[model samples]
Target: MQRLLPQHVRAATFDRRRWRGLDPEQVYAYLDRLADELERLTRDLCTANTEGERIRQALRQWQSRHTDCRHTQVAPNSRWHR
Candidate 1:
């Protein structure tokens, strides 16, 4: 679940002078890549949450269906006396 920079973005030391020298196009590309990654991560998290909810609901239903009921016993001598 670690976040990483998109493949297109190179990992390099950001010297102020070098950063300032980069072209506008490169900056725009980096921003676009980051946006795409963020969107994908958001979608993945939402799907995971939904699946977890479904599993929890299923488990609850199964537990309810399989629950044990209390039973009472009657003595044969008591019935015969009655």
Candidate 2:
């Protein structure tokens, strides 16, 4: 599902009732804070995703380079085999 962007939150409009309606100032202030948090979270998520892809690529390259050794057996006398 698509997520809401900071602009969406800032541009949101709510219907006001004749009586007992929500305070527009409070709603706008809260929306502003929510938008700010969403923007920060979006940035953080992007950074994390990019870093994760980098790590995945590095892991794939390392695995390809080590593919031959993956099937090799070590002697019983080898410290690593022990």
The parts of candidate 1 lying over 4 Å away from their true place are 1-21, 69-82
lDDT of each: 0.68, 0.95
The per-residue C-alpha lDDT of model 1 at residue 63 equals: 79
TM-score for all models, in order of appearance: 0.56, 0.84
The TM-score measured for candidate 2 stands at 0.84
The Cα error of candidate 2 at residue 22, in Å, is 1.4
lDDT of 2 by residue, 1-82 (tens): 8789999999999988789889988999999999999999999999999999999999999999999997999999999985
User: Number of the top candidate by TM-score?
Assistant: 2
**Clash number by candidate, in order:** 0, 0
Clashing pairs in 1: none
Residue 48 in model 2: lDDT: 100
